[model samples]
Target: MGSTEDTTSTTYSDASSSPTQPLLSNPAPTYPYPYPDPPPASEPEPTQFLQISYNYGPRPIKDLPFLLLFSLFALSTFAFGIFSSVNRNPNSSSVSSFSYDSTTASCVKNATTSSTLRSPTFLPLPNSFALHSSSSSLLKSLIWTLVITLIISVPFAFSVLVLLKHYTKQIVYVSLPFFVIVPIFVNVYWFVACTVSSTCDEKFPLAYRILVLVFVFVIIGVIVWIFVVNWHRIELTVRIIGVAADALSRNLGLFGVLPALTLGLFVYFVPIVVFLVLARLNGKIVAREEDGEYYCVWKQDSWVPAYYALAIITMFWSATAMVEAQAYVISGTIARWYFSKDGSSLKRSLRSSLRNAFGPSSGTICLSGLLICVVRFVRAVVDNAREDAPGMVNLILRCCVNALLAAIDFLNKFTINFAAITGEAYCTSAKMTYELLRRNLLSAVFVETVSTRILAGIILVLSAIYAIVVCVILKAASNLGVDSYFIAVMAWVLLIVVLGYFVHVLDNVIDTVYVCYAIDKDKGEVYKQDVHEVYVHLPISRNSRSASALVARTPLVV
Candidate 1:
């Protein structure tokens, strides 16, 4: 018994000491086990997934072929214009004096010296006495008009910024109601005045009068409905404008950049204008009589008309390109400012954005500009056709063309904003923008209307005030003569354009912020928490689920 007990103790001690003995006895579960360590915790089911391959550095050139094609076309056009101008005859008579002879019952060329006839040529040359006498005062008036517009617009833009930043709610509240009420009041007043006037009653048919009244009522109803629908969204619009104002205030350098771009555009236009003038001189001189005076007229070549069209189209394209480039710069810089990490500096953001806009993205800009130019050209044609033939069909055609132009404009607004942020090609940016808008339809519609109307109202008021101030100043201080009306009108239009630029910057900012917010929502992450919070109040849509499902199907790339 003592030996057995000692052996048992030794065996138990050996069993305890041997590490593999218990595993062999128990025999660990094989491949058919019901569970296995919960699959190593499953990576926490990521809350935010990648959507776009967002690039922070310079992106590869997109739509390069389009860029090349546009460059070739522009260069060819310029070369042809230069050639035409250079080959034009400087001594060609624009017009020849003709006298109507009663004896022959026909027109006859007067025996006049070329030099005398040329002095009163009808081409309105810069050195022509008639134009030369008025050109100085006209030029002086124009110079003063531009100077006044700049002076007013610069300060007005800053004031607008201040108002947008600090008084956005007030501006929106005031402008919204004013716009809604004023239009209705004007329409109603006109309708009433016309109804009360016997002359109007006699001139217009009863059916037309009834139609006008119905239209007025319908417009009032529609306006009220819109106002009511968007009333709740005023806060969101103000927030958006405020955000844009903040961005603009931070990047005040944009103001300087905008003027520089305008100057560059003006410089570009000078040569084109010269080309147009020179091209006009390429035609034959003909004698014509107007208002009892025999004068020489420049009969433009057949090709001259076509070349004028081309040059005008080019100007339109260039203007559109410049506008888009401005938008891209604003959008890109704002995006950088929006996504920048905390405590980071963005001193070079504007420069980087400029490089991106005119560098790899220039082709995209050119393409968009071309589309706008084409649409505008088509619209102009439709307008002329409508005037030539007033009918239901032409009217309907005009409406359809106008609608298409509007659609293109709306799509471009967001697509350019998206491309600015993502550095995507135009087509890709357009597709993505469409998807985003589809997902957030209500927000987009309401915010767009509210913001656009408010800005329009601001522009109108500011322009009117500036125009009045200009007229007063011109009357008080300058001897512009009849040019006062011309100067006032020019100054008014100029102020509107300058103010429009400011509005455009803000418009792009609003769009960029909305797009960035939509992206954040899609990714389930917020780059701008404040914007997210403010926009979170936007009514949710059922499309969010489908958007999420689509995201789930897409593989996330690290």
Candidate 2:
């Protein structure tokens, strides 16, 4: 009995203590299982440099600036040459402006031959530093201020909007008493201030006249509006802005203070000014319906750029004028101020400007001149095509554009009669937009008054007629025991062919990138453009090169 009991106990203990007991049980164990949470859907960040790669298509337009600047330099030099030749005592064509002291004598002697005579060339324009303000600060400020101010203002403005919904309510009845009482209080204070003995003299003239007019107008307008049914809600918008300013200040920091005011004024007054001017001068903006209100609808989506472009044009005109003014004015002032001192820098700068008037920097002036041609061509095409678009604004703007183009054409026809330097279209939206277009047109032109662009356009025409001649010459060379002409010159020929194709392709691709789709990402901000237009820039490329390993996996998004 004792032996059997011991065996029974041992067996039970062994069975209970086994490692596979869970398997033996009804439910199997689940050890080392994975996490229960679902994976989140999210996009990964792209390499920073990839954004810049996608910004400019293929390679940048480099030879363009060389062309534009060179042509400008050449034209100016040619003009001066013509002037010098005509003004020379004996009217000798031998006295050309291309005569530099080193190569001057040779140039003067070789003026008759196109092959030997060199076209004037110049370096590109120095990129200005003033554009940094809009770049470094404007975007940053917009980002920090936009959300805070707009969000906070929503409640108060919406409350006022709700109030407007019940226009016939007692609430509308009370606004009158407040407006009337406030004006009376203001009048009383003004009268008290005028009667004060110590401060009366300073304020008596302008203050009294302004206060009396305000008192009279406030009394009359408020009184008239109270009795008048169906009051215009548009007039109460100024009050909404005041409330919004209060809310914005309460919620956001110091930066938020100005956004409320600026945004409100821009939103309200931009249309006001646009419409008023269009009404007066017949500009090209048409009032169209959206949601319920009227807005200035441009013919093409690109025409919206006209608004911004006009503004940019005006702003840059002001900036350029200011820069030119300051450059010359400050330069002259410094020369006078430091007359007793060394004055070398001042003197050098003055001489530099004067020399630039007749020197290599005429390239920049010529570029400016060239922009005039481009602007006119584009304006002409857009204006003429959309001449019958709706709205008085469109009609007026079209007329203005037509006039501007005609004037430019007149200048082109009469002023030096330059057909070689004149055909134009551009996609220079902005530098950050990755549009780079420049041309060294003078290279072919000064050679024979025919341009490279013109030559490219005519290459198709010449190909059909001159192809037989080319084949014949190549055949002759092949037969002449000249082992293979291409084999001898393959490297240089390939390089030229590759580089020329590269430049043309780069220009076309970049222009397409800018006009069709432009994306600019700065800091953490993304700017994806839905509407694209012609933007002007002096061509430049980012300094990133040789980082192929990076910027390849994911495309940068704006």
Candidate 3:
């Protein structure tokens, strides 16, 4: 019994001390009941992702190629257009023999005649004599104005120079307009003097004529080269202007936007209009016949002060209203797009959008717009000052200010988007928008530089086509010869109105999309899930906080 007990104890101790295998891993096959077969390991499902590789941040270096191509295309197109315009049929109805009489403030209607009758040689003596006589007084007014301007500008120029020196900055030599302005002044004086004296009319000096021609050609060449070099930026700017105009028209179609915009414009212009009317009443503004031309002259220089005051008031009132209207329109556009509210009545949506724009959330948008407008206004003032004074130092100073203003303008648009989204103040929305942009710098750059440009270009082309169509229609319908200049003006206005409306729509669409994209990229996957794969692609990861957060929120787009 003692030996059997000792053997049992030894077997128990051995069993307890033996090495054991994990139950979850491979179990012993020889066990009484084998562990259930381990589930077969499977490979991770391939991630369905769109891989986009790009150099993040604003890449002005990458933009060089695009700039060059756009510049070349623009220059070529412009040259072709000019050639076509110059070579058009001389006998076309666009040719007119009407002469503008400044003295009478009337356009003299000449009988229908050949193109030769419209030449300089056929200009009536009464009109020519009137212009010649009036040139003396005009010349005197210009000289006095320049003298006064110079006297006032001297101290300002000195201060600008001092500030520029302290800052240790330099400006491009060409940007200093003194060299150009001086020559232009001298040339203008000489031309006017010669015209009044009638010295170069019948037997003009060939050498002088050739010299003038050479200078003009050189200036033209320089202008052409500059246009070619800066076509990309110029084109972009023009398209943006077009978009704003387009937006104005579209907003008008909606109930509130138009009224708001019109009110803003009215507020801005009413002061100036009233001042002019008062001036006319006070005999400050008068129309006088000089030779055969009509000259409207202000009776007193004192009116200038009042004019400036009215201008300032107008600018302030208009700017505020314009900003308010813009905010309302943009917010309405985004809301409609996001909520899939296309089926809703225009008046209702307009009312809601306008309400939201003027509501508590609109403070930031208004402030941002105000800041941009102020900076831009200052820049414009400085720009005009530079033209008048033409100092390198002042140019340098303005350049620094302009750089800052450009940055403000650049960020202002995005801030508006954020403001539209959350009704946050300008600074708050700007900060958040900036953070998102920093994280997704490459994407923002792509959308801004590439996407915006392409859309703008398409709209610009369409505007041109529309203008051509209008011109053709006008020509076909009209029986009498219409003035080419008049037709051109009409066409230009029409194009601006039409283009402004369409471009505004396009701009809003792009802005809304970009805002949505940026939000999704930073905050998570709401918009991405709803949008088609072509619109957006986000990485699938268990660790993504944004994506997870987004799942709880409804998608902004379908």
Winner by TM-score: 1
Model 3, position 327: C-alpha lDDT score: 50
Candidate 2 versus the native: TM-score?
Answer: 0.18
Q: How many backbone clashes does candidate 2 have?
A: 14
TM-score winner between 1 and 2, please give it.
1
lDDT of 2: 0.33
lDDT of 1 by residue, 319-368 (tens): 98888888888888888888887678988888988999889899888888
Which lDDT tens digits does candidate 2 get at residues 73-181?
4344334334333433331222332332233222223344555768788755455344554344434433433343335334533343344334414334445444455
Q: Each model's RMSD to truth, in Å?
A: 14.2, 35.6, 25.4
C-alpha lDDT score of every prediction, in listed order: 0.74, 0.33, 0.47
Q: Which structure is stronger by lDDT: 1 or 2?
A: 1
Per-structure clash totals for the candidates: 4, 14, 13
Backbone clash total for model 3 is: 13
Candidate 2 error regions (>4 Å): 1-152, 166-168, 205-558
Over 349-444, each residue of candidate 3 has an lDDT whose tens digit, in order, gives 555555655554444444554566577679879888877878788878888988888777667766676656555455655676665554445444
TM-score on alpha carbons, each prediction: 0.69, 0.18, 0.44
Candidates 1 and 3, the one with greater lDDT: 1
Worst 10 residues of 2 by lDDT: 416-425
